[model samples]
Target: MAKDDMDKQPDSVSSVLKVFGILQALGEEREHGITELSQRVMMSKSTVYRFLQTMKSLGYVSQEGESEKYALTMKLFELGAKALQNVDLIRSADIQMRELSRQTRETIHLGALEEDSIVYIHKIDSLYNLRMYSRIGRRNPLYSTAIGKVLLAWRDRHEAEEILSHVVFTPSTARTLTSKEALLSALDKVHSQGFGEDNEEQEEGLRCIAVPVFDRFGVVIAGLSLSFPTIRFSEEGKSGYVKMLHEAARRISEQMGYHSYPF
Candidate 1:
């Protein structure tokens, strides 16, 4: 690495720590002026002012009128709520997911959208020796998996596209949708049907079906999926799996405090 890059690394980390320190100080009270915040965080007044301005622009902090006092905004609470929701969601989803595994004897997954990708947060191994190989914390492309499709399908069309606008569509199999337009079209079908499919898209000879798990506010929070091999695939089986997944997802969503489960 260049000398400039090496020298800048520590500065970047220090900046982050300083920003958090200022936020902590601001959060300790209703509001504080730049001078008071600087004293609390042990930073220069100009430095505190700069960070506050940046946070204000990002909606995490708000300046009171034309005054120098700045207060932390509700944006931080909104982010914290999302984190807490996911924790509750995973704990409650386990019971339903295990039941689905027992019924189908197939690999089951619970995934959620993370950035431009779908991240596997929970999984149940198949009873059979042949099963889809996956584990928690693994990330897969949003354009090539059943869970990914369901995650994007429930969103507004334009918002979904914008989420994936910067992502490079790399095909993992011949069946993988390799463009935003193609994926968008499939998303329409998935949205209408209340489920999504991966027919040898992420990997050859592997098929998966998934349905959405909604939060109490009726927002799609996660996806529940069943995976099996082509050799075991059947039209009737697929339909049954879809029904089973929807049922399991409904129960999981209810456990997370959502009484209404669409499809």
Candidate 2:
């Protein structure tokens, strides 16, 4: 009834504890039978069977047939694999991002395409106090960010179009691309030039340049970018920033097992 009363309920707490116990027992080995699981978790056969059925229906546990033993599905492994990849990616990009920061004294970001949005997975802050303020897990729109554009540009045309189909063309600034056709045209340019640029598109007075980071399969997996303020940006230095970003991204991509860095 009350919050404190709810916390005093032993049944509710025990159910959760029991579920984790069953999962741990299953994790200790391959397949497990209901009776063996019940004994391992110190639960009744009926309770273990019920939890197994529930987990099975949710795709966490699998059984070959009505009489077969249950085993864990690959969903958990897939999630773990994705997390490991991000860890490896961040570790590999750290050195290069620091180098880029030292060379330009601007914010450096490493972002990956996540279902129509770009997520910052790693970053190096600018030396100046007046730099762009951002965090590692911030998500930015794909239509207005240099990292977003570069991540999308290397994709197959049909796939890229499909991905953009769900993206809302919201303008953040006067320079933002507010139409699918306009973004597509810009993407074509990014694909050809091997980089992407944000000229105060996502935010006023901020400029960013990004290059793609490839994976072992030669696929564009991430984008490495440099962020600068308009007051500090110069046309002559743009090429140098692009060159530095490409070199850092190239080394990171190579470490990721992509030897043929296209850009």
Whole-model lDDT values for every prediction: 0.89, 0.89
Structure candidate 2, residue pairs in collision: none
Model 2 TM-score, 2 decimals = 0.82
Q: Write one digit per residue (lDDT tens) for candidate 1, span 86-167.
A: 8898899888889998998889999999999999999999999987778999999999999999999999888898999999
Q: Lowest summed-lDDT stretch of 10 residues in model 1?
A: 1-10
Deviation from native of the Cα of residue 239 in model 1, angstroms: 1.5
**lDDT of model number 1:** 0.89
Question: What stretches of model 1 exceed 4 Å from their correct place?
Answer: 1-13
